[model samples]
Target: MSGFKTKKISKNPHQNPMQVSKIPSQKTGFSSKNTPENQKETSENILTSADKNKRRARKISGIFLIISVLVFGAIFAIKAVGNMQLSNNDEYKTFRQITDIFGDNSETPKTPEKRGSKNILIAGIGGRGHPGGELTDSLMLANMNYDTKTVTLLSIPRDLYVAYSSNSAGKINALYPMGQKQNEGVNLLAKKVSEITNQPIHHYLIIDFSGFKSIVDALGGVEVNVPKKIYDREYPNNNWGYEIFSLNAGLQTLDGKTALKFARSRHSTSDFDRSSRQQLLLKAIKDKALSLGILTNPAKISELIDSVRNNLSTDLTVGDLVDIGLAFKDMSNTNILMYSYNNECNGICMPGSYLYTPGRDDFGGAWVLLPENATRSRVSRYENMRQFASLVFEFPHLQNAEKSIRIVTNSKNLSQAKNIRKNLEQLGFPIDHQNAIVQTGATIETTNIHKYYDSAIGTGFDDNHILVEALKKIEPSISQSTGTGAKFATGTGQYIEIILGNDAKNYFQFKGISASMTENNNFSESNKK
Candidate 1:
């Protein structure tokens, strides 16, 4: 007790309760002085503290790393499950079987014989649980030209009357259900479509309303520019009732249900407008699917697969689809062309109209459309339809050029010039009737087609020989001028000019070509004597 003095422990509220004053001890033989031994012990203590801190840091880092791995693994598992569900889907299996039966299981996809083009018939139905679900609601021939990397979509009206059987006739939409009765709906429909289009149907895809909605939803909606306001007061609803559906004219994104309504609403507008809207939606979907990387993204691919699983059926194999996607990956909107035939024949149908409605009294009180030139007894005549298809799909260059044409005629041959204009317009020619002039002079004796080439304006016929050959098919006596003739100046801004002469009266006549020029009032009234 006499050898060392001990300090008391601090109990003050301001001081740390755990702090205690050190007492000098002689029995333990430890020194507070900074001796070499004490210094070594202090250094060891500091080193031990640093090691504990590093160990704690490592443990925390390890926990975070594990969590990250687990999260990524879960995502991968979900994606795998989605893909597995798609691969094992019953519809996908059926599709594969159907393609195998059709002999479309080759490594390379099949294409049409002409220009390496491929045509696929896309049919949309109402599907199960809906009235007339088996009947095709929409029919379109999608033609892809490999050489030009262009796509042409020709919409066939569902109300078109066609001979489904040798002894029976009905609307084209009914052909699908009729074939389904014989377990050959897809093939039968494709055959009929091929006949109508005059293009080989290399493949076919049939989807129902449910499938369409699902696919559109899975793609996160599509962007479309509605050209006009659509206000359908009698749109069909899910409960067999009518509902008002309206969309303002503008660019907007539409979901699955809204898009279906937009495409299917025909009560307010004509079927032709509905067909155009459908085509517009299709292009929008294509652009979204291709441009948004939906093909490469795992999550999106899984979603799309699940969406189309039981809802979609197609003869295209997985490899074939992949090949198509790759081939069309770089295509722009400019490369795709869309056409539809509608009968607005009140006074006269609009230019390029190929289908006309024969009064319901003719077909058992069922309203239907036949070829513009077709009679009730001859419903199978698709010459005009085929010619239009050829002009669109075969001669895309002419359509792409979008060259303006003018028909010049004297008073004597005015009617003949108008007739020729109708024929050319129906064949998809860009006839500039607004600027057409009627030369009030003596009738010329010869019909001449002058090509006005102006390098400065790029307003000339690049495919002169091809066009001449095509026109010759329409009029065998049509002569092509060797140069931009002095009589027809190039300053008219018209790419091609057909100066009608008295000889033009001998031009070939296309049946069902109405002589009514009332729709072109601007051209008619302006050129009136």
Candidate 2:
């Protein structure tokens, strides 16, 4: 396609209550109390012209009210996106003292006695001189709507492809690091997102890792299940991190440090898995803080407020936040909206199918639409923010176990599926599904092994199409199956699955050939075709 198209949804601005009422000010030449009891004697000395003018003035005032009412017709709906409205007066203090994003003296959100669904983006940064490690470990787009007495918390995967909504044409997280210089990263990300989701970001709550830890500690702690041990010998150290979070596969309470690990660890599983863990922790903290009646207890409330104020940065006032928070105090888990970028891209493509890719020339040539998870509507808006939504998928049946993989080009000799498969199996995966398949063209699968493995993790994910670039390097000798590539369902839910696409099963081997990348690292797609 020459250019991507976006879908737009507009909201009408809310009309002012007083505007509709249109009450006009009233004052005549004299007040009724001041009117003379002897009207006949007073009329003899009065200027008839002046009296006539006073009567006309009253008529003009009435006309002014009528004009005000007429002007009310021009009023519009007020739409505030990503604005955080506090549930209680106390919660307001937590926001003001804890956040710094609004600057030393900036206009922060004011409190309105009544509240509505206000959206907020929570960014977890590694602050101080170490902010260089400003990898946003957790990104939450929380929507609190008092109208429905519900809250929706959308957790975005750190690695999902999102347009920085700027000159940066790639991932959304890059907006932060790129922002270090422009000083516009976070805001830019918010703005771009506003353009993308059609929701304006009201306030940004950026927390340093320590502050995050403090908040968790204040909440008593959070609990999570350790899927695998993450040991990064070279992991950053000294307050930053290097220590591995080792835990058996079970539920356990996590202190600040452990909670940090729970949010940041990606060791062996995918970033998708890490996101799930953080979401679980967020819920745990919210539950502990609200259900335990932490706010209701004076001493405990005081301590939490202290901890929260100590760690958070924002532009919201204490009173405004307090009232907003109180409004939301009655809300439960289901009342929340959880928006996932992954879920947005799910089921957008067909499985086992290969789509055209933007060869190196496209960045210099035509805009190519690659097959992957993503909604066309979302892609369009993000594209305006200068980001490509192209996704690559590769899934080949493992054809050989001994050679590990056999080679092949399409009958057209356009791909290298076999070589890559061997590399992946050597990396160690039970990649029999790819090896056993014989077909090469597009197809769909009913029972997917990938979904089975994904569900095993409790994330319950599935994909319809395979990633092409990640696969082409693999050997075609892998068995081909009667399955399509990764296909995630929209709104309902989204997930990446391929029965171990010959490509992903082999990601470890490629990592070596390439270089080691952390959770925040993004693989380069610049080396087109």
Candidate 3:
């Protein structure tokens, strides 16, 4: 799990068939009871209608030659006042670092070469009523590619088992609880995410329980649609970890207080569902914020910004933020993608704990985890802080060629590393020189990839079907005699590395597991005991 905050954009990539980056649970602003799924959709529709209404209102008035100019003028003036306050707000300034003039000097990077798209990592700290922060409940990577006017947002689930900078591995959310005491909880979370995504995180904003509520409040209120009915007996609220917040399903309007509940509630749907709801609420908030004049009020902006200074941490300068605010100043609430990681990546799981790891024999077919295409793209962004498996599923040459060979490699082996480098080179993939991978256990994952798409929580893969089929296609070598290949394992071993092709061009790899692990016949609950 990493940074997972909501940002605004107008492009609808969903219609084109979405390949999504998940949204973290905490950064989702839906802690209210009113957010049923229907209501959520309706709210989105409302935003659209609002846009149309605004256009129509302006048009009719314009044709009448100031038919309603008197009213609009007064309204605009009132809005201007609030906008002025927010513009001058020091609190907001505190959170935004002025990259250009910090403490003294000025002049910031302007061109693409100098002022490239910056990456900001935002985390949501969850813990009730305490100045000392908590664990990072959600993770998100906000990539603003100013050059393309295309922003790439990726959400990392907190439950994702990832290797941390401390050389520790655990659920992504715990990074906060473990480090927040020192005020670097958010920093550690960002660093972990940076390691995984390979992207240099320029800034971090940590919003604890209260800060989250206030931001929602500042935006007036957010509208949403709750997807499922949720009933949690005792959820966290302050030091009390088991207080319940009940709600029915469907469309509804949520004020700040209720919005916090909805966003924070782990009610009906799975944690994945919670994350989805949170994403929707976030979009609503963004839409409202962009629509309202409050953003222009420098004074109010200062107050709102100041209100959360103690609650946030960032490396961004004022100029950087102001620029970002302006760029996104008119984001339409049209396009958004939200997804969640499933237990399939880890296999079977426990309620709020225990992500299981399976053995090889359990795998039903030859398979590769990452696609040949998105591998470098995913790796460069993560920067190697987290270990990634480029699963190498070997195919026996056709006509019952040689036995299948699955090579598991790690960042350790020198020769296989050379081969991997070759593979990538042949492929012409860009490598992020600053990959900060920290290897943990020696074993790589053994997954039944077919089970991946079939899982209850799958992310859909029409394009990925091609990758799967490609991995399964093994060209056979010349063989007069037919027989299964030999299997050998002598004694205590280390790690294994396998590479495909000569260079980066036709690259696929398996970089872990020195000795083989047998598959389990029963991963289901009924067969377990």
TM-score-based ranking: 1, 3, 2
Q: Cα RMSD (Å) per model?
A: 28.6, 21.5, 19.5
Off by over 4 Å in 3: 1-115, 127-133, 162-170, 177-185, 239-241, 339-341, 344-529
Q: Among these predicted structures, which one has the highest TM-score? A: 1
lDDT of 2 by residue, 312-353 (tens): 556564334444556667767655433333322222211112
lDDT of 1: 0.62
Scored against the true structure, residue 453 in model 3 reaches a CA lDDT of 29
* Model 1, runs deviating above 4 Å: 1-115, 345-351, 397-403, 454-459, 462-477, 485-491, 505-508, 511-529
Better of 1 and 2 by lDDT: 1
Candidate 1 on 254-334: residue-level lDDT in tens? 999998888888887888788889989988999989877754554565466556645656655444554576677898888
> How many steric clashes between backbone atoms does each model show?
0, 97, 92
Q: Judged by lDDT against the true structure, how good is candidate 3?
A: 0.41
Worst 10 residues of 1 by lDDT: 23-32
